[model samples]
Target: MHRHFQGLALLAVAAALAILAPVFCAERPAAAGAAPSPDSQSAAPVVIQVDAAHPTGPYSPAWNYFGADEPNYVYSKNGEKLLRELAALSPAPVHVRLHNLLTTGDGAASLKWGSTNAYREDADGNPVYDWTITDRIFDAMLDAGVQPLVEVGFMPEALSTHPEPYRHDFPKGDIFTGWSYPPKDYAKWAALVTAWATHLRDRYGVESLNGWLWEVWNEPDINYWHGTPEEYDRLYDVTAQAIRSVLPNALIGGPDSTGPGTGRAAEFLEQFLEHCLRGKNSATGGTGAPLNFISFHPKGSPTEVDGHVRMGIQRQLAAMDRGMKIVASFPEYKHTPIILGESDPEGCGACSVATNPSDVYRNGPLYGVSVAEAEARTYELARKNGVVLKGSVTWALEFEDQPYFAGFRDLATNGVDKPVLNVFRMLGMLTGEWLPTTSSGGLPLDDILNSGVTRAPDVNAIATRSEHEVDVFVWNYHDDDVQVPPANVHLNVDGLRQGRVRVEQFRMDSDHSNSYRAWLDMGSPAAPTPEQQAQLERAGKLETLGTPQNLKIAGGRLPLTFDLPRQGVELVRISWR
Candidate 1:
């Protein structure tokens, strides 16, 4: 550590970080439901090296998969604004997914719930398809240069076995009684799906629809599905056939089981794949279903301990590790694309800080850094498992008209961007092959999932090199909210063409690109004044940490050092003349 960093300025920064410790580490009453406090420590400086010339693989734009529960929210004022902002993040195709596209009701968006009355049958039992609301949802995405990862949906009223008890009011009531039931008639269900696909293909063009992935349903192995294992297999068979009838060679896969932990979800994931591989098709009476890709959900577990948030990032990563291992072990599906349909810090996106105190991190930089940590682990697991980790859809998007920093796992609260949203902006800026990177303080992937970063912060970074740019992303992450010492990073970048360079640093932390902080300073306004609103709007965007700096690289090596606060993420971009 002395060899990597030894300077008075560094010591001063370290001391200042110590002085500001209580801001992040102070204890609050358990009932106050505040964000967890990280244990205070004298952070050791981490030495990381980025080998730009040794490109490993393309930094696949797999991070663009975004979703939410409310389908109609796509066209809402806040939703439209957020969607367009998301589209602008990456040139790589952004695939949007949503729920309740086929449920029965007037289009109304709510927490943990949404509905679009897309299908109905008349008194004569004749099928009637209303593409109105669903089309609007699709149109909003398409118009913004975004596409869909079509989540072909919850049972519609006309076809559900028990449609009367719809509109789940979970965490508040038990109306989720019927939406989980299987279709009353398999034939009607198949026809409804066929018509839905045909409409999308016709309206959006077959070529465009072909580019999108058509997943059979959301998580069918949990409360999301009230059917038995064999019954879900049957549903998948018919749904796949129905979709393929219109969209030729349609991409489909599922079971979308909850994380492959040692329980019912894990068992269901294994059994579902077996059924897809060997069981007779319930629709065609042929062995195997048309499975192009496999999907599942892996969510983190955050528990309130001593009135602080101790995130279960390891639990989520372990689940993904086991899940990928299961898929890779199967010789036939070893190389198939894997989409973890719902990847989040935890389940229950609708549960806010209002009820769940552990979620207090949603308002600050913790959400951003946690996502960065998970993404790094996700890629590591993919390489270890040897499968095409296609996309891990972020299960939360925007909730329009909510109070500022409402503490849902959302990209934004009530239209203003959250710190988590800018993390993607930092990721979107990288476009090249991944450079070999090693960090002294980074935790090993296996060790992280097995235990978590309890003893020290996982100070890590990822490097990418393009023809004209070298991008480095760093984050300070730990499972517990204890305020660890600032990760003073001394990044030694190698393999650069020795010459003059320009370096720009962007940040997402309490004081930058974080509207939640700005809102809190303004008295946690339920409704901000016009000037406050304007202030938050500007605060919501991705902002630079400081002015760009000029430097020179001699003999293809350069070293840059910066301090990263707890739960903060930083990206340094270098370009040469």
Candidate 2:
């Protein structure tokens, strides 16, 4: 069958599975209920079945995208190291999105703040352009072999209508400063963008620069953009036009609004799409502006409940659902690629546990499993909605000079990788076409959408098939942070041509591939010695379960069983030998 047709069929099967009478309908296995404790073993096994004969559509590496609000960190010592790590995770070039590229400042960085001073006026009120800081930022990305999802935003201080208070102190005070406002002159704004694009094209040939992604601004439905909807749309038009003028084939899109689960955000997204399809172009007098892709942010709501953190996975998924539904409603742009500009456990990446205790999940396997589950379900949601999801940016990066395991929503703290980063590494291992898989312990999509995983742990698996191997990515996740028993997973794979296969498994839990737990075991050091730091770095990387196992296949089926702890993620690779 054609790959596209096969993917549609697979989606139809998934839709049917969502409405099954009994949610856990994969094979005959005992019920895998809530565990007794974090250390206890599971009594019942959750059976997961993977059919490798059928090939779905080609897999898209959506999890490779990452971003941060602090643009200056791109060149910091730790930031550059983290960028290299991110680039090496996958064969595909990672795309990074950043904020405050045009904001005026001295090229300093802090929590939720960064600047390039790319634009400033001369003594006689003429436009002055400086690409030094911006070049350093892009140069770092290129040096690391990553693409830039350039966010053309945060009005320059010289052009902002309200430029007195250009920067803000975040996590302590308001962040909607003067730079968030619209430009005082649209023509000047366009000129600034044009100059920036021209410089990028000149420095790095047009062919190299054309591969970069571009977007107007971030979260216009919220404080990130201080303007009316029409005004923001106009700004997008001008910015898009300016970039294309330098490189006509640039990939650009906009409105990067907040989550659409709320009414106002949904309306904003819908109006923006409608305007893109029909509204007059403010830059060209054309019928509509150029929209190469759609962008939005979907964040969860995690709160400290009863002294433990309870994640709001449903909230984040709902936003994705609503946003895709809106896009699918418009035939003119339904097939356009959609990028989740900032998909995370919650907003406020810079907020630490000292202020927001619920963010403690950032340090352990909870964040890892949460991300695995979210990315897995997103593939299902995209199939159901018949829309293409290009990428989902994990709005996190390294925070320089921070405490070890400080509860900030970041991929790394003080140059040490977190457990969540290993999850991305595991995801990066998955390639080729998707294979149909179902888990007995997984709740239906509607059930998860309605009540989350609070009732029972969500033990699920998504599998893929390549020419040489088949990979199954499994996760045991729960919304509540309470300790639970490990789940016994019986993964059955069919349609392998060989009589035997070599199995390799990678895990991220409290005991493996987790730097936070390692640090805690070391008495939670304030500053680790160089030797300890090396040990922590080793522990932070993805670790396998001992050596690879050679398992025999019976009746064209491979049965592999393992114990997966709650808030844990595992990637099982079966290689043909």
Candidate 3:
């Protein structure tokens, strides 16, 4: 086995051990509230019906849901180490995206190449292409069992109409330099993609390359693309044709604009879709476009209000709903897979500077809970819209060699798993099949909407079951703030045959695989002592809450009750013989 695979296996073992350790063995305060007695009248089970009849997808595992963006900083030694470390956690497949690969030039004028920064100009102004940097990045992901949600973006410098002032004017101390601008030439852009696609087919084989989803530019409606919608359409046409020229079976598609149903994004998506269906390609003069998938970017807000973090979950969901509706309007796009590319709590992946206000949430549980909540909601929206939502690419991953707590939006800090990653680990265990379930007395849908439940709504539950196993994931989270009132939950599971079902539970809260508080205990990672390091080692653990219990089934119902803290997530798996 490859060394990375071996390393990943070891990390998995460690995580499993941490999750299976005796709950009482860990040093911690007794849970503030007691587990409700089964016979207690007030603790009566809130019976939720499980519809075993209505099922979707063969309960087989859906894609492993995760998010990633290009980490230009990973070019440094420390950044590479951090990426490898994060790769070990949840070795399940991840969706990796290239945010600024099409950027070129320098200072206030550099441009990125999106998926691969392949085109560079020599001193003689000739186009020079390099794949070594991206090859290493993709290799690392492949070794980790990750899949690339290939984002074909920013016009390569040699292809951009405006190429000289290529890069963004990033503030001082910003590590993301030279990777965020439009390409320099269009023909060169097509050639670069064609070459890159052929290279992937050569290096990883055509079969492997076929599985990757090719997305066009990122947030063309926003700062990512300065071109007008018509120009972007032309760019898309040429790029799609180019990609197909090499890999005819390549899954190519994207408008990748920001929030396709609102503001400028909605306008951009509508125009792109219309053009794909009706607008004649100047080159081909045909209505049929190579649109295999539809993609758009949706981001939540990360504003600090009233001394607590506020996430814009509603805004994102609304965007998703609109995007889906727009796609469904066209018969041609009805079956095309929709991707929520670059879905996150906020925009600005490289906003680590002090001037960028959104960087505040990057280092704590705020980011973790926000990511979990946002993803879960995205899934819900997709089901509601009845659209085939394929991937919600998290615009975050490890930045290779930044400081221990450099404030970059990442899944880990200095090789430690963040709370956000714990959610993915929990998700990885739930791949096989989705079962039917019902919840008694959840916050009404309208109540959730009217009250802006994105802040602090109500208890939410989702369940999935297989032949012998049933998994129930429950959460007690509110939208706007972290300080939530304690709530008691009575989970009543029906439809289980009378038998002992072994139960395993995993949880995320103020503790357990949480690096935010660990950083705090370590004095903010600014100054670290030996003891602090030890504390960090202990703190970055996913603690087992309790031992797996073999519960007796009675009267075709099983009852379990526990007090869930605010912003907490719980996973329960019950398997019967």
Candidate 4:
């Protein structure tokens, strides 16, 4: 049956090629003084070098690289398939953080506890916490070999400071409301977290729970939290203390505010840290607050340029660098591990408008390119700043159950893996060792620095080494959508004698391993039938470029030249004989 499917798929691809042949054949006049195309004769292979020392550090192996935080929406039937597909891509334990888990009430006091809400109340009107929904979601994650980043968030319904307008309705036509608000009762909020932590300890065991990082609310500096900076500081102090009270060794940290270096995020983090180090806890009156780590959110802007989506990779990195510097400046927080809890290209997760919408980029090669470039840059920023940057979670995963293709900003669409997820799969297969490499005939970093083209032609590449394997990830992307001129990529690999090496490559682009375009080909998820569903499944499959085989190395370097499409990413893994 699988063979039959493969044959049919091949035929389909052949037909597609035939249809696209004309598009590929058509060409405009070459530029003035441009070299003519080579005749049917032999052409020299472009030599690129890969070095062993000047490499970017291994990708964050322990962080939530391909994780999302949409529990309420993902648990539904439609969202489930998308989540499962994302899990299957790199089933190696991932972290899926649940955002807005609490915040059950309509106002600050009316905690309408239910299955959707993480907390519940008894028949007697007393808050009777229920872990049914939380358990189900976590179970699904665990079953998929994914761990929960375990974001302890929004105040429970019974505890929110203002419950009258409890769960805010999804904003109309791309506008979101109700996510930003302060909890009605800080004590109640703290108690709920304590109870939730205690329950997890009882159920998942203290040691098991200890492995997870407990982050507080998301973007407390923005509309996500309505409380004042001082109020949030007090809230963090109480919440941290409560979690510690339940499980003293549990990893607890946050102020998870907006961009930590600028605006409200920086102020919130500074104030929060200062209070944790010095302010007396309103609940316990203790001088030393429970702050296991420091965290903040950094997001990029979404813009539609030249009919394509471009992510602000540099802006986010700049924010991250600034945030790290700010944290490092504090004497008390100098040693704290920093986590960019909700790091991504944009802030609004639920909006999916096609033209310049928050989620538009998720549907194309732009997402894959953005993620690969951002990850590489994040590592670079960390190295230059000399900070222990821990996890940089991609703020999206899969919406459990939504319309087949409602265009949500998630890693998967209707149970099909998007191109972005393929990037994570490539990252996952990488070994955790840094190698050295250089690029020639490419834009110099200084030129890029001065040009302020942070998003375009941002040639960020990284190589990881194991005793026997070398993995190289290269991405060509720019922030603003623009045509990137092809440049010779010269990669030099050193420190090894000529030996047999095998290369396995994976690529994510408009025509490869992209579920969004596939869905569109199947008439979009909005109008899906069983046949379309099957096709969507097939589309989600990550495509391999070539079979692994031995290559005779002339020198220590392997050289090749290929045209990289705009917003394209390539992962090459080489192993020696």
- Tens digits of lDDT, candidate 3, 1-577: 0000010111232221122110001111222244223233123233344433334554322224344444354444444554454455444545566555544422121111124556777788777877776676677667656566676755555566555554434333322322334455566667787888888889999888867878777667765566678877887888888888888898888887787646667888888999988897844668757788888876655455544455666666666778888888788777888877667666655555334433545565556655655666666666666677777777666654355655566766656666766766665556445555554424444343343354223455666666778777666555654444445667777777887889888877766667666676545666567877667756665655779898898877777877666566777778877
Kindly give the stretch of ten consecutive residues in candidate 2 with the minimal lDDT sum: 1-10
Give each model a TM-score: 0.92, 0.93, 0.82, 0.82
The digit string of per-residue lDDT tens for model 2 on 323-345 reads 99999999998779999988887
What candidate 1 gets wrong by more than 4 Å, as runs, is 1-43
Best by lDDT: 2
Measured by TM-score, the strongest candidate is 2
Q: Report the alpha-carbon TM-score of model 3 versus the true structure.
A: 0.82
> Model 2, 234: alpha-carbon shift in Å?
0.5
What lDDT is reached at residue 318 by model 1?
A: 88
Model 2 misplacement above 4 A: 1-43
Candidate 4's C-alpha runs over 4 A off are 1-48, 53-63, 66-69, 74-92, 105-115, 118-125, 173-185, 306-310, 354-359, 400-406, 441-456, 482-490, 521-525
- Which lDDT values do the candidates have, in the order given? 0.79, 0.83, 0.60, 0.60
Residue 478 Cα positional deviation in candidate 1, in Å, after optimal superposition: 1.2
* Model 4: per-residue Cα lDDT over 167-226, one tens digit each: 443432211234445666566677788888887788778767766778767666766667
Error of 1 at 229 (Å): 1.0
